[model samples]
Target: MRQWLFALGGLLVWTAHFFAVYIAASLFPGEPLASWLTLGLTLVALVVVGWLGLGAWRVWEARGEDELRPWLGGIALMGAALSAIAILYAGLTAVFF
Candidate 1:
């Protein structure tokens, strides 16, 4: 359970941020509040993803002779990178459009 959570943490955060931004946009329509909310959410998401990526990187580096640990860390790191890109794109689109 914990391992799965660690692996999917970045993706989960991205999903949550995506939904939150969508809801905020729907609620606020053309209001500036929606943009503000999106900006805040994007920053938070980035920070969280970055933290997760760092942890994953540490695991990857410290894997030593272990094979599975490196794989897990690599997957998590990739997920975090992808999530960051998605979060940024979504945030920009939501705020601008």
Candidate 2:
């Protein structure tokens, strides 16, 4: 059950990320971002997603352990932090770039 829950959350995160990129590209089709800046943003997004995958892996590995709270809490905190950072980056990019 815990495994399934983590799997579902990961899938949802992936789907959201896909749509987010689509929406961003659509909205900012003609922005003046440097090629390197664009590449860097892409890399940052990948790192955020990678962190999510790591969190999911951690939860899955600790499923049978008694310390599930720490795993879940850390994942939640990381996810929130990633999301906040991404959103701030996007807003700043659109506003100033």
Candidate 3:
């Protein structure tokens, strides 16, 4: 439902961050500054998504099975996990490529 929007906020941020890094890497290949820039951006994105995910989990716990909250929390946590993995993969690729 509408609550899912809140759940997906972290995911949305992550998608944007992913593409930003992708384009930056493409546009500035082999540049030391580009690597550093992508790394910094990736770190910041992880922190933000992680915080949002934690907040959703805490709220869900406090709500105690309330309608919609659990779904929101579950999805948020999943999104956070996905984002972290995606970011790490992207980061390693950025580093090694």
Candidate 4:
């Protein structure tokens, strides 16, 4: 039940990110930087959402399994690493540009 909820939440997050990007691009077709900003934000959001969805899937897979701890740990680690990279990129982009 919890796993399903988490998966649903991840799906919602993914959908929301796409919708936001699409709306931004559609509404500001002629604005400079609009597409770039939308793409950048969408990329970041999608990566984060993918990590979360992967984590949720891992949790779902681990529910009744005995040897799933390692996989779950790996998922968490991967998610954290990706998030860190995204943060680093955003910070650098903000500072330099």
Candidate 5:
């Protein structure tokens, strides 16, 4: 449902970005186009993850007495952080190697 999607959005975006970068690298090989595409994807992914993290932050702050909501928000926030790290690593590798 919507809740589940929100919780997993970071991981989903990370996965998609990873695959897209991989595909671009494969398609372009050593071409500069591949590096450019990876850079663009990395920037997009960072922005999206940041937005998702902000949403999760709001959810976490507004959890109040809802224990489940807080946990969901924390998980989402952590996932977003992890996804951002992954995206950065993949982007750098694709661009440099």
Candidate 6:
């Protein structure tokens, strides 16, 4: 159901994001294109996270902040934010190194 996904979509995106960056790093080491592609991917992933987070927040609002699952919505928002930060960190680190 939409409710269930909104509560956990972020973490799923984060998992895919983690693999994409790491795989790009390992599979295309020393390639300039790969580095740029990774950066591009990071940005795209961030946008997706933001969109999903906003959607989740909207869903939470619509649900009246379910007393029994308030944490579910909050966690989704937090996870999206944390994952975005992680993506930025990875991209910056790669750029610098």
Listed in order, each prediction's TM-score against the native is 0.95, 0.39, 0.84, 0.48, 0.95, 0.79
Q: Across residues 1-97, which tens digit of lDDT does each residue of candidate 6 receive?
A: 8767776677777788778878888888888876887788878888999998886576556655467455666777887778778778877677557
Question: What local lDDT does model 3 show for residue 48?
Answer: 85
Per-residue accuracy of model 2 over 1-97 as CA lDDT, tens digit each: 7644544453445455545655666666766543334445555555655666677556546655568655664665455456545644554454356
What does the lDDT read for residue 82 in candidate 3? 85
Q: 25 in model 6: Cα distance from truth in Å? A: 1.6
Model 5 Cα lDDT, one tens digit per residue, 5-96:
88999999999999999999999989999999999999999999999999999888885777899889988999999999999999988888
lDDT of 2 at 1: 73
Model 5 stretches astray by more than 4 angstroms? none
| Error in Å for residue 49 of model 6 | 0.3
Candidate 1 residues lying further than 4 Å off, grouped into runs, are: none
Q: Worst ten-residue run, lDDT, model 2?
A: 33-42
What is residue 74's positional error in candidate 4, in angstroms?
16
**Candidates 3 and 5 compared by lDDT, better number:** 5
Ranked candidates, highest lDDT first:
1, 5, 3, 6, 4, 2
lDDT of 1 by residue, 1-97 (tens): 8989999999999999999999999999899999999999999999999999999999888847778899999999999999999999999888777
Q: Write the per-residue lDDT of candidate 3 for residues 8-46, one digit (tens) a residue.
A: 877787898888898888889889878987988888888
- Candidate 5 yields a Cα-based lDDT of 0.93
**Alpha carbon lDDT of residue 48, candidate 2?**
59
Query: Stretches of candidate 3 above 4 Å error?
Result: none
lDDT of each: 0.94, 0.54, 0.80, 0.55, 0.93, 0.76
Which parts of model 2 have CA positions greater than 4 angstroms off? Answer: 1-5, 34-41, 60-97
> What lDDT is reached at residue 5 by model 4?
46
Is candidate 3 or 5 superior in TM-score? 5
